[model samples]
Target: MTNSLKNLTSILLLLFLAPIVIATIQTPLVTQTQLPEEKKKEETPIVYAAQLESSPIATEITEPKKAFVYFTHYQEAYQPILAAKGEKVAVYHPESNITTFQEQINAQFAFHQVETEFLENYNKQEIKEYNTIRPFVLNALGHNKYDIILDIHRDSMKADVTTLKVGEESYAKFIFVIGGEHENYRWNEQLANNLSDQLNKLVPGISRGVLVKSGKGVDGVYNQDLAKNLLVVELGGVDNNEQEINRSIAILAKAISNMFFQPIAS
Candidate 1:
């Protein structure tokens, strides 16, 4: 045949064998079993996980602080109907009953048993009650360096001004009265503010906020100069009954417990 026809046949034959030849050339390279260990490791799929199963988890629990509570106006009864002969007797004597607040606190916290009641109205005379109470507190402090001191009293305001409703319970709302005359006033204010915040969280409006007093018509210091955490808490008012005051007390105990107890991460 002609040279041109021969060349054409050769070109067609080369084209048909090209793929086979290319496959043969790459077969050994792809099928090679000897790969470096480092190269194989680089090609492996990564598996990520933390080995924290053995680690201990943290608990949100803590110990309570040492605390004390007493009524300076022990006989300053609520809603006085008639004035007694300088004895300061009223309708309700918180000293006789509401000492249960301190008892409740004792159940959940480190509380000093300082349920002192002065038969005479020491609160009547300018600073007589405070003077008497301060010495007792100083004595109490000598025995136990308490972290918190509460001088509990009922306010003279009406029920409407001092009552608050939390969920299904109606409570006598309380206020923290800070004596600004003391050098550690800020410390007392901080504690009061913290207690107020915690109480409001548990029962909104249960806290009437902190009231500051100093100078005329009132005992400014209220003997709060004795300690940094001393607070004069006015619980409810004249219209608040024993039950309402107790309800407030229970809630107050919880709030105080929470303020002193703090959780730490493990």
Candidate 2:
């Protein structure tokens, strides 16, 4: 009887322990495997966010260069265009003058992402035009910083000296005049030389080279003392018509864009 009782108790204990072991194996312990994968998914977005923050496009922004265009001799006119309209004077016109070039210049500069401001209205009655325009230019400079300042003028010389012909197209030639009297004249000369080189590279012989004037009977300073980059550009002469002058303005705009605004390759 004692042996039978002991055997029965052992059988009952084995049957109870077997179901617990089976249940533990059948139900998977997924927490250990799934935790690492969840962490990896969470870290991926953080790494991608860091990469975007360090990108050059996100960090850097460059603004377009600004140029100021003015005319000391606003009435300077083209002879051919004047004659066509039956006007008497070849060099001067009250209404139709070099100031009209502001439209063309602004249009061309806009294409190259350059901002331009024109000081068109000034006292015309003053005999000393350069002196009259000086105050206005100084005031403009005081208010805003200009990268380039141009005093556009027309030469008294004829077409042969002021025109360039490339194939069938005629272009008005450019002459960069620097004042030799100023203390900072060399800096202005260097700027002129750089532009001359750039212009010639675009269209050979389009520039007549830089000319320095300083002695008596000339406005030696040409108001260039106000700013180092201020330059007097004699665009064409009395003989160059509207079409030629327009072509030259377009070329000049491109040269300015390339020299000052374009980025250099390493």
Candidate 1 lDDT by residue in tens digits, 1-266: 69999999999999999999999887856434666766898855332111111211222333435566777766545542223224354645534434434444443332212222222323433333776678777767667667678888778888789887544456788899998887888888988999998888767778999998888887778878888878899888876655566566666766776665645337
Candidate 2, residue 64: lDDT: 71
Model 2: CA > 4 A from native: 1-62, 264-266
Residue 121 local lDDT, model 1? 29
- Per-residue C-alpha lDDT of model 2 across residues 151-198, encoded as one tens digit per residue: 999998898899988766788999999989989999889999988977
Candidate 2 overall Cα lDDT vs. reference? Answer: 0.81
Per-model CA lDDT versus the true structure: 0.65, 0.81
Q: Report model 1's TM-score to 2 decimal places.
A: 0.61
Error of 1 at 41 (Å): 56
